[model samples]
Target chain A: MTLGLLVEEAGLFSTVQDLGRQGFQSLGVPPSGALDPVALRLANLVVGNPPGCAGLEMCRLGATLRVTVPSLRVALAGAPPTGDLPVLRSLTLREGEVLRIGRVAGGAAYLAVEGGFDLKPVLGSLSTYARALIGGFEGRRLEPGDVLPLLRHTASSRRERALPHPLPAERDRPLRVVLGPQADHFTEEAFDALLGEGFTVTAEADRIGLRLSGPRLAHAGPPEIASDGNATGAVQVPGSGQPIVLLPDRHTVGGYPKIATVITADLARLGQSLPGTVLRFEAVAPEQARIALRRQEAEIAALAARLHET
Target chain B: MCAQPAAPPALLHDPPRLLLLGDAALTVEFAAAWSPEAAARVRRLAARVAVLAAAEEGIREYVPTLRSVTIHVDPSRLSLRRLQAMLRDLPEGAEATAGEATEWCLPVRYGGEQGPDLPEIASTLGMAEDEVAELHTAGHYEAAAVGGYPGFAYLTGVDGRLALPRRASPRLSVPEGSVAVANGFTGVYPATAPGGWHLLGRTPVPLFAPDRPGRPALVMPGDTVRFRAISPEEFEGLWSAFRDGRADPVTACRAP
Candidate 1:
């Protein structure tokens, strides 16, 4: 079948999400989307769903979803369930049987189907802001006993296919970043210290931003600058001398000086990492990062194509 | 596309400086600090950009922060280059809306246990506690911005005479509805959040609510608010009425 099943038990933090609400940043709203884009695309492809269709984003400890109707294609991708578990895991759920995701292998997972999940749009977005309590399912985290209705789909074609295979979980990949436009705001010593040293993800991390614990990266210039726009991977060195890496739900702007920003290609991996994940940053040229991003996109597209063929 | 475009660069520097944020986002910033003029200008620009992005569906989401805007896009369909191009042709700025804007009359119970820092703030600003309370409630303040924790309305027009710095070390948690001021801005913490601001009093009003209609924020940008000091009995009665949903915020503030 096309549309999979409704979620009977939504794990840690689960909600329907797409690429997030974009143009509204000017409204003081952060664009919330799937944490792992690569996995999200793959899941959509595996289920024969449109690549842009909204999918379920599951955070640490996935939920137990029960497949209703008949059989359906589904794929799960995110950080490997702890211990280098494969990113993509395949499991079947009977009409009444519950599929449970134990503890989080990674912080997030993507549940995709042959047909996209049907959800009403809020401000033209299916993504949830939990804080604003808008978008997604009533704009809040999926709780136990929440009955979600699925977007109906057609029967599957006459074809047999092997379940999706998991990708190698790079739980320990070095975070690749590009020097920020404000890199000059930090001292050469602080900049060097940032790249040369390592940081551990603190427990105080969330979709808003990742707080890191390591050598404080002090601002070499004025501690305060006019508030400027920043993105998810912006490495903002706040007044505490500690760097806070902004994330999807980060504020629209900040006054802290940023030393560098993690290249966009690596943000998903960073977002999926659990607390205490040791991270190191390796600078990449902007051109190189762009090329790498294109390649990554192509790979995701290919993976989706493979699933459709089956 | 690699070469920088030649133009006057509008009000900002050359090419309207853009920084690649991560794999999926980019930030177009104006300057370093938060100036009211810059904040206003940025807000206007952000509103226009948001409208354009929504109309085109080329971008995902864009949020307006204090001084800049963050646009979240689907890298697959819209690349940084394309977004940059879209930014170049953006409609410039947001037109200031007319109408005096709705004014909110917030009722608060001042002094004693409710406001621990009231005396300290009064001393710091060299004004009597009653005088401080009088000055605070006398004028209407324009909401300058709404950031730094959800529902935290940063208001303008604090009695400049009562301005004081925030505590060196903030308390772990100030109860929700605590009215506080620091660094030339006065606000009521919508929720229980750690803050170094000077406490003035407590308002039982819900500043931030998720279930309410119309964006879920009590006081949004561009609203004017005036504080009214009330008795503890009034505070308790209003708190009960609000919690029970029997009273509307507008009605509560309007009542004597």
Candidate 2:
């Protein structure tokens, strides 16, 4: 039987996202995906879906969805609701029940449903790239009156559950980075300026990237490099001296000189950082970055194992 | 001059310099200069890398640009050092084979509402609007790289005389399929996007159609592009045919 949900009131911005659209960078396709992948995986797992299942990623004020199916199971992660509602826990809604998500405490949140979204993967992913007008539901942000198809699910005994481990709390620690493919392009003073001072996330931040306002970094030589591939969390400094932390929706290639790359483990924290939040950068060894990433992965696996045990 | 013989591959005299683009990707740059020889060398290296990627585990994808190839990898499955070592072992100056690239003839409607900057561009270059269009149509351009926007090909090989710098203030939105020129390169905007390039014309054919099967982009890196001017009436006719699925924006041509 077919199942679905109707968006009652679309909030600030909501789009369906999965792990990413992979293997298409050569064609200049951006890997548009969930900004907070950890939260997305967790939310999906809570709903008994695979980690890469497509889910709704909401920013700021979240959307209100009405269950059109006989019943629907869902889980929320990342930003908690400002209201008394408990999140990061699995919950079920009856037919005609409305799920209201309030303004995000942080920057974004992920809502995953049981059996995942019933959508065809574009270029092997359901992630939405609004700029290119591809992927997701109708290749655009969710709005009122939009109906989303849901993968049919069989009723299960375990309808509700809570995460064994609490979601990671937002910390004020410095964002760790691994210094560069183009570190030599800048003077030592530039490095000092980059790491020594603080940067405020500008209002221009979005799924594409975060523009930071901080002390201007001085280039020792020409600022332009032969255009090269850009990575998620690549800290690129253009001629303006302001750094841009690229995200999932960033262009595949860029000409700006990248001074550092934020470690994989810290990307979730970066994703949660709201505009006006001050951030500091800390340089770490490549080995340290890898170890941190492995640790996070291990934690995720452990969480999944724990959930299965329950 | 609309169709020229494919450039002979240049022998890689100097070893490519490799730089780590974070832990997940590495860039192999052949030369800093933008020249046919440099582009040829980069393409050859990219081909070699593609073979390695297919044979080896952990390599995700590779993007070939004007003078370099960037290979993305899974760090957990493959170490940066090991991947670098594998690349170092590849044979240097491998003779590149010929007749592998495809040539595409794209139809464009010049001047009028489609291209508002045509007169300004022509006057600035001391040439008539038709002369500007003719010069643009004459050059056989190569797809240097496809980026900046989805399916937007950074084409090279615009005639030196028709080369123009980007506008001081970029247009808020350039219409999709607008044929533009800037800094010795000619390209077609795959979608409506903000751009600074001087628009000379617009093509009814979509450069990028995600809905199309097989290849979503009409042109990829290393493909040759030739523009043929069409009358406004013909433009409308071809556009309708394309919309109705009777005509394709791209057709295959054997490399000469």
Which candidate number has the best TM-score? 2
Q: Write the per-residue lDDT of candidate 1 for residues B1-256, one digit (tens) a residue.
A: 5988555434554334577766456676665444565566556665676566657665766655545666767665677777888777765554334334567899998887888888977786677888788989996787766665666777877777766777899999898899988777789988787888888899989887645556456777667899999999999998899889999775565424
The two-chain DockQ for each candidate, comma-separated, is 0.29, 0.56
Which tens-of-lDDT digit does each residue in A1-310 have in candidate 2?
3458899988888999998888889889988889888999999888888899999999887899988888888889888878766666788788888989979888888999889888888888899999898899989999899989988643356747767764565467899888887888899999999999999999989999999999998888888876878888899999999999998899998888899988778888888878898989999887787787788888888877777322
Deviation of model 1 at B165, angstroms: 1.5
Q: What is the lDDT of residue A53 in candidate 2?
A: 93
Write down the TM-score of every candidate: 0.78, 0.93
Candidate 1, residue B4: lDDT: 81
lDDT of 2 by residue, B1-256 (tens): 5889865446433667777776777777776656788787678777777778878788988888877888888777776678899888888654335336678888889999998999998888888999989988898999988888888898998898877778899999999989998877889999998999999999888788787786688888888989889999988988788879787665522233
Where is model 2 chain A poorest over a 10-residue stretch in terms of lDDT?
A: A152-161
lDDT of 1 by residue, A163-257 (tens): 35544456667788888757778887887778888898898887788889898787877866655566778888887888888877776666788
Minimum summed lDDT over a 10-residue window in model 2 chain B is located at: B247-256
Among these predictions, the greatest lDDT belongs to 2
Give the TM-score (vs. native) of candidate 2: 0.93
